[model samples]
Target: MPAVTADTLTLPRIAPPAPAAQQRPVRSVTTAPSGYEGEGFPVRRAFAGVSTADLDPFIHMDQMGEVEYAPGEPKGTPWHPHRGFETVTYIIDGIFEHQDSHGGGGEITDGDTQWMTAGSGILHIEKPPEHLVVSGGLFHGIQLWVNLPSANKFNPPRYQDIRGRQASLLSSDDGGALLRVIAGEVGEHKGPGSTFTPITLVHATISPGAQLRVPWRPDFNALAYVLAGNATVGTEARPVRKGQLALFGPGDALTLAAGTSQPAAEPNLEVLLLGGRPIREPVVQYGPFVMNTREEIMQALKDFQSGSFGVIPGERIPHT
Candidate 1:
């Protein structure tokens, strides 16, 4: 849970919502089901039951392990291909290495973010460092897939390595919570990562019994996913807990409050607040490819099989 930490008293405070601002109401709250990803690493399918319409501009999300891995137990993804979307991987507690066929590679740890746009197409791999694999430790993070609109689906591939300290840090009005804006705008502050679609991604840690109310774009759809502990969402105070996601309805602002008590191991309420301007286009996905039509998906598969993505670097070890 130590993705990034700052003293709330020293951070810029998010202004309270105006009296007339409408607080977004909770439309639904669903629990994420546990699953495995990549080399059998644990994950929570964050958008499992949510409709694509409600998650427009965002295709998929996996809350990767909050698990403490024993020595020689850490694992990672094999070489894979992706197209028509951006993959945002935020490392919260451990080190993770990423390498793509286009010469973009790096090791990120503790709050760092790896933003990879698999526009057109690209081959990539994500794994633990050799040392981490030999001496395993805690690993926790989020992987979010943001869909590109039809027009920009074939743009050149790009990568952004956003350091944890580069995030825009802010505090709740009462200084009871810390907000790390990793992408998009939060009030007058902006984060480091850039995206093809307009979206706001914030990781907030709320002290027990604290409440957070912040302004949101009326045109964007809002969602809150709990990473740790219990919390209540919306003005109506609907209860939500770890692994649960709350979908919000249209409004000018959003509200969330931390419960007074939490699990001993998780003393605070950790939540990811994300919203994006809807793309509202037909989405057809097949395996690693996300496209606007079945024909486009077929073409993507053909392109990948034909070695159009790019060649793997000779120096790196290819994972199976």
Candidate 2:
């Protein structure tokens, strides 16, 4: 993947649109994240194991932190290899620095996002910046694994670093909601990250009693993950709170209304809305490799062991 320089980082601007009429009722299938520890940080795995089959195209989602780390206590994932898919990391707070075999890396701070396509293969490391690790502070973020279609599983690796200010912002006509487009189009706004499959990913915050109706492709499967506060979703008006993932039924649009009461955490309701066209391909995954067949996964392992996964500058470790 080529490094993103100032000349190439362009931000998209779209005029905000009037709120759409409630055309379809939104329904929600609620699920909770299972607790687990990754590397050295604790995480809440929202999509894994049993939920993997239902969230096609999206194999995993991890809610990292919201926990404070004492000085010298912070930790992160070490050198690792990934293939056959892309990883999207959105930083809500603190700072994370990443370095990969392709020599692609940068720091993603509050509200920033990083999208890494591990097409053929790549080894990488992500952790708090050295300064942050020494100073200690709050760290919070979400990481999602998006599965690639079979045809593009072995394509060249790439990366996109999207700064918080570069993301397209859309406001509700009534001034009750704000949305940041990370990928795909939402109303008139478009995100900065390019995706292999047709998908929409947005972070939204709705004010109390405010209603948001966002248009979406009817063919895509849509779902919302609440990051903080409470909100009623879909036409069914099912209530959901933090740490819950809500899968919406078929609909041309998504309807969300924030509760009047103050949320336990933040002042406004925050949720991550994600949708993608189903690939409908058989999924075979092992560790960080996601492919369509077991043989393909085996090939990825062999490539990594043979040091064919590309080289990371200054990396001295070799596969056993």
Candidate 3:
């Protein structure tokens, strides 16, 4: 669970909510269902039951393993294709190697992020390095799919590798929580990752019994997903735990309080705070392609089948 950390006492403190600030209220809380992804790796389908309308600009998310893999047990995705969206992969406690047909490749470890925009179309693969495969350890991370609007659906493909240390660090007003802004703005601070759509992504660790309240954009839709431990969300204090996601109603600010106690193995409440300006456009998703219409999806298939997504490199790194 070591995505990013800082000594709260030394970090910039978030200003307390103003007296007139309207605290967001919880609209719904749903538990993510356990599932398996690429090569049998465990995952929690974080947006399984959420509506596409409520998750506008954000299509899907998977909370990848918090599991400790025995040597030779780690798994990763095979070569895949994507279009009309961006994939944001944040590694919290392990290493992941990514390679795309367009000559974008890199190794990202603890706290690092790989933001890939599969605009128009692209083929890529994500896997563990040979050494990690031979001597597997802990692996935990998040993979979020951010949808591009109709106008930008055919933009050029691109990639951004955001290192862990580049994240903007801040502290709760009371200095009881650490907030790592990985993308977008939080108050006057901004993260390193550049996004096509406006969005804010923050990973916060709240000490037991601590409270965190921060101003939120009224135009953006707010959501909080528990990565570890337990906590309560919204001004009404709705209970939420690991694998649960809380969606909030429109408001000026949001509030969260960690439970007084937690599992022995997880002593703090770890939450991923995310929100984005709604795209409010039609979304059509096929196996690996996301488009605005059935016709576009058919064209994407034809393009992929015709080798238009770029060819794999002649020399390849075999998966361990």
- Best by lDDT, which number? 1
- Please give each candidate's TM-score: 0.98, 0.89, 0.97
Per TM-score, what order, best first?
1, 3, 2
User: Which 10 consecutive residues of model 2 have the lowest summed lDDT?
Assistant: 1-10
lDDT, candidate 2, 252-293, per-residue tens: 777788889855567778888999988889999899999998
Ranking by lDDT: 1, 3, 2
After superposition, candidate 3 runs with Cα above 4 Å error: 315-320
Give the C-alpha lDDT of model 1: 0.94
Instruction: Using TM-score as the measure, name the better of candidate 1 and candidate 3.
Output: 1
**Of models 1 and 3, which has the larger lDDT?**
1
Superposed model 2: Cα runs more than 4 Å off: 1-28, 48-53, 315-320
Kindly list the per-residue Cα lDDT of model 1 for residues 112-134, writing each as its tens digit. Answer: 99999999999999999999999
lDDT per residue as tens, model 3, 163-265: 9999999999999999999999877788888998999999999999999999988899999999999999988899999999999999989999999999999
Clashing pairs in 2: 25-235, 26-234, 26-235
Instruction: State model 3's lDDT.
Output: 0.92
